[model samples]
Target: MRERKAAAVRERVREFALELPGAYEDFPWNECVIKVNRKIFVFLFLGHLVAGQGDSPPTVTVKLAHPEAHAHALSAPGAVPTGYGLGRAGWVTVPLGEPGAPDAGLLCDWVEESYRTVAPKRLVARLDAERTAPPGA
Candidate 1:
């Protein structure tokens, strides 16, 4: 049912985040968290694991740089400002299972942006180089 579908979505998003350079997952508080350079960039939560958060499962809480991007992301369905004073810093909770949740592409984009915001400058440079470098060189 919905739980199965949501689990699939979690796996796909996990794969996408781990594909980024230096990204890895950790089980802090038993919740799946993706990190880059030892800094948490993405958090995946389901069920009451995110208790009191009021957000649905298959949710990704990410950090954003610009207010415009934060505002734009909040405009999407099932998207909400992250709680615990995090929203002031452009963090948002985006539900992947909602009827109008952002597509895979946009979510990945948000993940990338969050990574860029938190990762060390050297690591970010490495990521950019990989993207700009010609194939096989």
Candidate 2:
């Protein structure tokens, strides 16, 4: 039951990550990651995929360029700096299936921040333009 919920949350977050401009999935090291312009912006870990992991919650790791957002994400339950020295570079791992985890909307926002941090300048500009453009224009 927990694994199912975690899978659902993982899929939702993965879909949201792919919606960003130039975003796509890649499996380097056999782990799912969302990338923009060939640079990874989100690393998704789904609990059910590995045997014996047993209800390990889904987590997303992102590199946050904004200090406020970084601090905010790290405040979540089970949230922490990403490992392998990525933490020093502002990467944060946020568990999605845990109690008191941030909602899907907030997770999406963090994914966008990561995208903006890693995506090329022109792509980021395009994303900004789309967001600020008039509804009908």
Report the C-alpha displacement of residue 43, candidate 2, in angstroms: 0.3
Candidate 2: misplaced stretches above 4 Å? Answer: 47-55
Best by lDDT: 2
Screening candidate 2 with a backbone cut-off below 3 angstroms (N, C-alpha, C), the clashing residue pairs are none
Lowest-sum lDDT 10-residue window in model 1: 47-56
The TM-score of candidate 2 is: 0.87
Candidate 2 per-residue C-alpha lDDT over 1-137 given as tens digits, one digit per residue, 9 for 90 to 100: 75666677778889998987888999987889999888999999764443354766778888998999999999999888887899999999887767788887788899899998899999999889989999999
Estimate TM-scores for all models. 0.88, 0.87
Summing lDDT over every window of 10 consecutive residues in candidate 2, give the lowest-scoring window: 47-56
